[model samples]
Target: MVGYARGVSRVLVSAVLVAAALLLAGCGSDAPPVSRPSSLPIPDGFTRVGGLSNGLVMAIPSSWRSVDLSKTDFEKELEASGLTGATLEQAKTSLRSLQKSKALYAMDPASQQESPDGFVTNLNGFCQPSVGASADALIEIAKQQLTSVNAKVSEAASVPLGQGTAVRIRYTLPLGKALINGTQYYVPSDKGRTCVVTLSTDLTGKNALFDQIGGTIRPV
Candidate 1:
């Protein structure tokens, strides 16, 4: 179980960073622009990075560096989680594993589901709890932490994840006094587990990046 917990944590953190990287990559700071080849798919001003598959879709800026779970250090952390018997390849596969046995609960706007008062609000009821409890619990914790750090909720929408058994919270963290924006996705795995992705950026001048990359998100 400890190994599972660690594995989930790594997945959550990595996912959030990946999402953030995409968002950041799209944003721009107060600096002169550098020339690039016109053949690139990303617009001249905006950076594009990160994407999703398996019934999920998202795109972020190209400036941020996506965390690579295949790195040896990351693998070591997964192994330290008491999952010595589990190979690094297995850990990576498990991060995105989807379960088909569950379904997301009906969206009940009146179901006491407040826009998380802070970042770390509970997501237990987002989907059926048949998946691992640790995954769900960690999501709640991450939300609270993120909320604390950003102090404002830009957006929050619920969407289906895999099949119908899981759900996700897609939102953005408003730019703070530092002019940084954070975009996040809190997704529950098909087994009713949770995975999170976040992107932080300085969108001072390049607001169009959000417009271009924002449309890539869709419910599974």
Candidate 2:
């Protein structure tokens, strides 16, 4: 999954969020909540966000702001994160590349404001044709790609996500003096596509929180 590698690279570099493409148009506005089984463990106070057309949905912290990647004006948010000049421009470029692929991105405002070097803690998701590859193989590919970038693969296993289980890979990448901790979930979906959900953060020991949020992914 070259797309998965590219997605991971973008997150490591630009600090963007992830999920399936065609997420609801209005970034911060509440979309109609998808009906979910009560047994599913969604975090308290989290908000349900998804795209109506694609029927893919995930829950994010209510405090996190969803960014409409297709929209141009996130300059205020970037500026608020203390980004300026080339770094800011590179980030915008990375985001726009995701936008071109119709991906969904979001970020935690507090993390963004507190980061030492403007690497915003974030999540992003997008769907790509699986072409008959098994979920395990896809995740292994991601693991390899991450390892190539000097990211330490801490864990790799199957976990409940969406309609079935997903292969979850947790890793930490050291960039300069900062450690970026993240998890990527690979869920095989209907119609021969795989849905990828990723979460990256500057804080450490967030596996529980990350899994809790990733577990909420579902295709409507």
Candidate 3:
């Protein structure tokens, strides 16, 4: 039930990032993919954002704002990214005080999405896993947490994403009279970083924006 989970995605993600940031991904330096075979055109209405400098890239509608780490922590992140070669546990604890943040690259109110209405989407990046965590392990962890409350989890599977692998976790959360469906694409890059792309709507299935954005991801 971990990935099947809804409201808790933010918390789990933030905690995970802060819990293991320094060890897994050391202030990721910007680098561009040398190939784009898995790449697809950016959706017609969406604009591509981010560049090699940020260490990742994606496409989304133009309305969203790129969230920034709290200004106070700016220098802190810079400092953490510089050090290397620590024991696994030390790197994990080092992230305890860190702030885990995500960016909302697209949000459009004008668009029409009902059912479990959804309007915003986010992209997240996590670096190498010293534990050598795989896509299956990621899916398994999410399922355990989400199943505790009897969340409906189905179509749990892993697919190759570029040179890496991605776990697709689909689930529904009961909200009184309505049920919210969510689709999460968690990809661990060939380089060892992880990218999580998610979409949740009160509606029944996938949204165009969601599908479109998924097309542009090269993953590795």
| CA deviation > 4 Å runs, candidate 1 | 1-65, 73-147, 160-177, 204-220
TM values, all candidates: 0.34, 0.72, 0.56
Name the best candidate (by lDDT). 2
Which scores higher on lDDT, 1 or 2? Answer: 2
**42-147 in candidate 2: lDDT tens per residue?**
5788987656333356888898776555345645554554445665565565666566545566667666556665566777776655455444555566677777
How far is 34's C-alpha from truth in model 1 (Å)? 38
How well is each residue in 1-220 modelled by candidate 1, as lDDT tens digits?
A: 1101224343434444322322211101111111122222444434433223222234434332222232334434434433223232443343322122121101112211222211111111111222344434544555665565454544444433222222223344543222334444444433333334333344333234433443333322
What lDDT does the true structure give each of the candidates?
Answer: 0.31, 0.58, 0.43
Backbone collision tally, model 2: 9
Best-matching candidate per TM-score? 2
How much is 1 displaced in model 2, in angstroms?
A: 18
User: Looking at model 2, which ten-residue stretch has the lowest summed lDDT?
Assistant: 21-30
Q: What ordering of candidates by TM-score runs from best to worst?
A: 2, 3, 1
True lDDT of residue 40, candidate 2: 45
